[model samples]
Target: MSLDDIRGIPTIELPYETIPVTEASAGIQRILSLAYMLVWMQSENLITAQLFGRSPARQLIFLMDETEAHLHPRWQRSILPAILTVLKELELIIDIQLFITTHSPLVLASVEPLFDQEKDKLFLFELNDNQVTLNEITWAKQGDVIGWLTSEVFGLKQARSQEAEQAIEAAQAWMRKDDMNQFPENLRTKEKIHQQLLKLLPGHDPFFPRWIVRMEADD
Candidate 1:
């Protein structure tokens, strides 16, 4: 491929189209830049081997931080697999070890089909007793992204706004006749908690039916 300097910005000429790295979307730019770097490394290794009779490297360790950054959910789902596929296709690279960090549940879900229990391990950094501890997490197939959000990895009580989670917690405390020392003073009463729930939660939220039925039963 050819490189052209247009207005001081480098552009790559591909078979189908020419793309200026600066003009492309953030996700596209990141992917293009990574691919270019890998190809350049391979070429450099080949030239070194030919010129100096040096042995080519056999293994590569790739460290990627926030693998899902700036990527759309669809792209996040495919990116990890795509990277592995590209490495396999590279003639010079024989083995690859990838260390990737991501907060997107979609990224985890995407790898479920490819995860090998014997070959791979998942790790979690957890806060315990005010100390940050690292633990090796067992890999399980969460049926979907939502499941991942609520799993031990994410530790979300509900996949929703902060207000909704608090409202639901207050409502539960009221329903169970528990002490309200930790809840907001304004939300301690049943009526006030119910109003807060109505304001924060959607009408179709599953919590509504249980709360409403309990209220009716109390009456």
Candidate 2:
């Protein structure tokens, strides 16, 4: 009921309750969740054993859903590698498998530097033409988080806000048109399109030439 009662490790006492980790943030709570899950899986009780200090199996598989949940960008980057280290500790005598679903670009960018193609693969689930499809892609190193956001795994055309995304799509649609002067939303003039693109995309964007020049050339 008191910190001294639990070997000075702290505890949550009822009514006049005091949680072990007072004022802890969600990121810390995420770590505790993982630690507790490991403890329960191996010992069924938190007090019986220290969770990750020793190997619990020769071969093990871990499937994590949204491992980046509640973690900051820095933690998101380091989480997968840290989990792998723990799993490797558990799998001292054999190989291990990790399947994790994540939507964080930081998470992908973090793994980009350390992922082994021989031991790892990236599965991308894309919704296209109202149907969902899965593809296995060769692991690629996207050194920048923005690059990871635009990568096929993330399926983003632009690593910008929703308005920017809409402008880029509109520009693309305009470029695909047979007539350069035709603008569906009164973006007919070259100046209008140029200004819109400048607002939506950075100067060095790869699509700049295609949308700006090619569209003008057709006129």
Candidate 3:
């Protein structure tokens, strides 16, 4: 039978039910992975506490592949902060060893802020054509990383250039034209005209870009 049919079976009865079906499904795999991670981590912590009458110091090795695949860029920004909180919480009882592989620049940028200069805890490795290069980054505090990323490492600051303003304005003008109905009586014709207007005008921004310039002046 297919995996979905198998997933409906309870874990205690079936031999193959030990693996979570939620993890097998591609759509919800990330969520399932996170769930399994939490469950196993907590279970281990519980066992350690019971054995020692208090949680014993234990090292955790966590491996994650393409960790940001299911996350939005904005949401990806929170990953490091969440990891820090988890580490802090676990530090009271156990030691943690985190290992992750990611293709997302945002994910890399997120961790840049967490580097400790005095501790010398941050190391970055870049791989290309089967060759790996290592780089060390040191920061006095987490906030210093934002400047580092904006400065040389990722060049995120270049995205703030003045050319983005012109592009935004052109896109807004196009959207305004698209909203007008040339033949309001004929739905199909009006739609065609609207589509044509959209194609002719800037398609990037649906709203007028001029508003941005005005806002800048007011500020």
Candidate 4:
């Protein structure tokens, strides 16, 4: 068929009609692109063995960088699981190894159920004392996205805004009666810190009760 033929590029069938892969949304396009690449690899493996009288590939190594870059949070939560499912369904006659790097906590949380301590590993890139090091992290399951965000993998203190985090830290320091010099001048006093906390934290914030009880006791 000519390059412009309907079969030239992959298409998705919709309820009303078929649409070219190029017409799909960015998220869909990214997913379809990955599927096409893996399918092509499988096809090449089979073809080389049959037509060229060569041994089929014994393994495939797939490397993906920031795999969740363009994906929405909803998709990010499921994409890793879906990819693993697809890989299993492909049933290729070769072992497949996947190397993926992602910044999304949802991506890491999604794999919690599928993580194998024996077969899978987690590594962190750290900059220490002007030297860069790659450290192998012992895998531990963080129940949800928030857990992953605050876990060592992401190193987030509160998974909150910078202002809110600072306010919280200041509150914690005040409660512990720590040295006020360590905090911003505005956050050093109970009244000022309370106002800052009120402005930054929502009513339902967990930090509220702790601060409120202390404030009420001192009054």
Candidate 5:
């Protein structure tokens, strides 16, 4: 079935059923996941609208586990925002509660924005072994989610900066060794230096196409 058809389905069972997209089409799968999430949010909105006239005291609790499993980083980034938007939209209509467990950094980054200073409606707990520790994220007082993320509690900025710097250094080294024959004789020594750098590097870029473009440009 097409992605549009999959999005129309109310519920999707995990593990037992195939996600309907292959690893080769990761970008498409990410888009499909987002569409499915939005559709689910709309369904919840409709259900809450109907309950408003009747049993307004009825509580709805949604439990999402490993929400970022099949999603790419780009799509994973959307999960928290979509959830927060749904919660805010349904706040008055229904008493909505959510319990989500995720290992994705993107998911955590998305949720860091929803904390409120006046109300303890949002809580974040980190689990280690059998113990759970709650993190006192002060985003509500910070005014911006990005600001709070860069703060000591989150340290997202430092982590991202380090990762980016390593990536650029690796990319530069890769471009230098991409084609030894294409370069002039005088530049051949640079290729040996690049090979040494590659051995010293800690990580690999499996997405070769993005780096391939830079290799071609160097010629």
Candidate 6:
């Protein structure tokens, strides 16, 4: 009915369809939330009308920063698909150009079926050698979200925590060492390797079985 409690912006009274209801959401229940709602609600109406009308500059471009931000997993998965579906609903088949940046593996995995190598381009943003860089990723179906997290795009070796990855890397480094044939020249060297392995790796880790086999084989 009235407006108040705006932190930074000027608040205004706006009308909503205030029909009698048994329940109301926490968001729409408050004046502050209502003010925020009117802003975005009007923004979507105004921006679309201004940009996508029948004019010579008819090409539409959307630059979405962190497209998966504030979205639930299900919504993150459906976002790109929903956009394409909306395009199909339109009378004119306008070529919509979307440049979206996201860190969500779910967002990346969701588009596997719809990604066209010829039409859609994928780039992996990275910081290598203290410089920001973009690398073109060759399109490949990872089949699952976990695979996408571990793929070159995400640059995760095992989709694990920092400590776990370090342990795995240490184990791998041991395997790659040329001293596999001469793993231990003495009891001291053998004990050092044993302590290092146990310190870095958990006994129940899947890497253990193969590691034990390989160590015994070396001995």
Top lDDT prediction, candidate number = 4
Error (Å) of candidate 2 at residue 28 is 1.7
Clashes of 5: 0
Write model 2 residue lDDT over 110-131, tens digit each, in one string: 7776788887889988888999
**Candidate 3 residue runs with Cα over 4 Å from true position:** 1-28, 45-57, 108-114, 127-130, 139-219
Q: Candidate 3 local accuracy as lDDT?
A: 0.54
Worst 10 residues of 6 by lDDT: 19-28
| Candidate lDDT (C-alpha), each | 0.85, 0.72, 0.54, 0.87, 0.57, 0.65
Model 4, position 94, has a per-residue lDDT of 73
Candidates sorted on TM-score, descending: 4, 1, 2, 6, 3, 5
> Which run of 10 residues does model 4 get worst, by summed lDDT?
1-10
Alpha-carbon TM-score of each model against the true structure: 0.84, 0.66, 0.46, 0.89, 0.40, 0.59
Scored by TM-score, the top model is 4
Query: Alpha-carbon error at 73 in model 6, in Å?
Result: 3.0
Q: Higher TM-score: candidate 4 or 5? A: 4
Number of clashing residue pairs in every model?
0, 0, 1, 0, 0, 0
Instruction: TM-score for candidate 1, please give it.
Output: 0.84
Model 1 lDDT-worst window of ten: 1-10
Question: For residues 1-219, what per-residue lDDT tens digits would candidate 5 score against the true structure?
Answer: 576555543333356664535533554566466567756765776777687854334466767777777677777878667767867776766676777766555666665566445654434676779899886554444334445456555556423345343444445545655654444343344345345334543446443455546655766
lDDT of 4 by residue, 1-219 (tens): 365665676789878788887787788898888988988988878888899888887887879898787888999999999998988776556788889898898999889889998889999889999999989988999898879889999999988999889988988888888898888889999999999988988889888998999888878
Residue runs of model 4 more than 4 Å from their true location after superposition: 1-19
Clashing pairs in 5: none
TM-score of 2: 0.66
Clashing pairs for model 4 are none
- Candidate 2: where is the Cα deviation over 4 Å? 1-23, 43-57, 93-95, 127-133, 166-186, 194-219
**Total clashing pairs in model 4:** 0
